[model samples]
Target: MRRFLASALFLSSALPVLAAESKGGFPPFNASTFAGQLFWLALTFGTLYLLMSRVALPRVGAILADREAKIESSLAQASKAQAAAEVEAQGLEQALAKAKANAQAIAQEARSKSAREIDAKRSAVEKELAAKMIAAEASINETKTKAMANVEDIARDAVSAIIEQLSGKAPTAAAVTKAINAARGE
Candidate 1:
């Protein structure tokens, strides 16, 4: 850097001498200062190259490297977060599926239990009704027997009365019973 500064100061000092050597034409196009122009052009280009290579380029390269590292780091973090989210989602889905299965099992078990209870109750009710029906049938049969007996007695009395009125005689018990039995197709 100090060498570049020394050369630039030397060129600045020599500028007036090169201008004086020009034959009053455009300074860059004048043949008289051609060698000086080439010298100064080379010096300026070399100084700019040295400045860019030694200072500006290294700073820019460092900045670019930092930016790349930041980008990679950010991407890695994002991928890790995405993977974690996927794992959590899978866990949640599994939990939900398990819960659903449990709920269905509970519902099925409850339904079976309720069905069993209902069947037991139905069987009990059926048995009770059957017993009541049997008792009712027996009572009906008894009533029918009693009514038939009373009807037979009434029939015998009516027949005896009718005969006594018609022929002035009463029917005997055995004759009336035999007649009733014969008329019944017994």
Candidate 2:
């Protein structure tokens, strides 16, 4: 596109020179004059072509080649960068997956540990409660035995006192024993 624009600009600038000198100041077309104009146009075109091909075109071609090389190099660099970015992204994904796995494993371990701890605590509490209940039962039985012994003594004393009050004398041992046994409903 740049080449086409440049060529158009060159042709437009050169038009006045080509139109200014026709033969006889302002003559119509003839074979000889046409031939002359044709010859000069051809000569100019050939010389310009040679100059362009030998010097101008070669320099321009070198510059265009350099630009193309630079552009291709830049594209290659960008492609490498993109590839590196993709690799880094993949690495990050893998790391994240590993981290997630580790976290899950840790959570599972924690859950298992907590369950074991809870079970242990429950068992310990149950054992303690059982021991306390056993102790309480033993204590209750001891208290009941002591209370029964005290009641028997009190009954004997009360019977002896009642006999003394009624007879105005102490009862004999054998009689007291007999009386106590009868009152006991034995």
State the weakest 10-residue window (summed lDDT) of model 2: 22-31
List candidate 2 stretches off by more than 4 Å.
1-58, 111-115, 169-186
lDDT, candidate 2, residue 59?
A: 100
lDDT of 1 by residue, 1-186 (tens): 999999789988887887788556445556878888889999999999999999999999999999999999999999999999999999999999999999999999999999999999999999999999999999999999999999988999998888889989887888888987898899
lDDT of 2 by residue, 36-65 (tens): 898999999999999999999999999999
- Model 2 CA lDDT for position 2: 100
* TM-score, cand. 2: 0.58
Name the top lDDT candidate: 1
Q: Give the TM-score of candidate 1.
A: 0.56
